[model samples]
Target: MIRLHHCHETRSMRSLWLLNELDLEFELQIHPFDKSLRSPEYLSLNPAGRVPALEIEGDVVFESGAITELLCERHSPDRLGRNPQDPDRPDWLTWVHFAETVSQHSAALTQQHIALYDDAMRSPIVMKLEAARLGKCFEAIEGRLSTPVENRDYLLTSGFSAADISVGQAVYMARHFVRLEAFPELAKWYDRITERPSFAASLPPEGAELLYKRDFYEVWNG
Candidate 1:
């Protein structure tokens, strides 16, 4: 049996979305995005005490990227994964892992804007810097999408794959902090991928608590 421990709107959302896209049968365990993750019982599944500790049969998988890679390999290698011999393998890996590059900044901004809570505890400098970094990340994606190619609707020239799911979910979180107005290509690409029904299925259920309460966050006012 495959089981995924998830928190609404966290990195785990990527894994959940991929699972939905692959039409996999799995149990979803929703956890409160709080200290309870550090509890010994939870830690047994994922020593890092992070969301997205996936259990498959007797094996366990941690880290969002690893989970994405493993799931695609096991279930959708031809469709969502570019295998070692495929021409797009390198590009696929680069873009898939780039999701975390975008996520690191969002994680920091989340800490500054929400986790810290106190005005004094938040750093406007860190907020501004991270937000700027996210813009740079967006620029990278914009440049990629702008590359001359026919029917370039997805990251990989081949077609939509797990790479899109990984980076798309990261963009979903990053969008809470950065507006897409400046990057027209990136904005269009994001809208296109998210239109898929699997993306809709990954959304936090009604009345579920969310990690990001705001649609947008400016640098800390204090």
Candidate 2:
């Protein structure tokens, strides 16, 4: 069975969501971010000491995007993995990579500079720079969603795919760094993604204590 080592309120949620979308049964190993990640035993599982590590057939895989790809390849090949004979295979692969490349930067920057900084009060200039950078990244996503889609409601060629799962989580995180109302198109997309049964089902129970307690404003208001 696939085993997921997860921490609440992190990109690990993406892995959980992917498994749910794939309709695969797996064991969930809940671990506290502050403790388990640094423990000697856990370090043996992942040198980076990050949450959302996957153990499959005795092999460990870390990184949320990679984990999602692995699950799709193993259990939901028809939905996410490519068919070599399909002409759209290249586009599908591009969509998968684009999610992390374009959407993850802003959220990562905000978390590192504003949310997690040790001396946030002492670095007003850096904070402003980070905010500006985040804004620019959000604008890029807005432009993409606003572009005319041929027929699909998602970022991919047809139906939802791993690209939506990856990029959707990034956009969800973006709420921490920018106001969703400011980006109408992206906000629309966010609402649509959240409404999906797969996405909603992946969320942890409400009020469940999270590993990193973030302010509500950071989560919804951005």
lDDT against the true structure, per candidate, is 0.94, 0.70
Residue 138 shift from truth in candidate 2, angstroms = 2.2
Please write out the lDDT profile of model 2 over residues 81-195, one tens digit for every residue: 6665666567667766665654455545555544564653334555456566667767877776777867646665666677778777766665665677888887887888889
**lDDT winner among the candidates?**
1
Indicate which candidate wins on TM-score: 1
Q: What is the C-alpha RMSD of each candidate to the true structure, in Å?
A: 0.7, 3.5
Model 2 segments beyond 4 Å from truth? 102-122, 211-222
lDDT tens digits by residue: candidate 1, 81-180: 9898999999999999999999999999998988986788988789999999999999999999999999999999999999999999999999999999
User: What TM value does model 1 have?
Assistant: 0.98
CA displacement after TM-score superposition, residue 69 of candidate 1 (Å): 1.0
Give the C-alpha lDDT of model 1.
Answer: 0.94
In model 1, which regions exceed 4 Å deviation? Answer: none
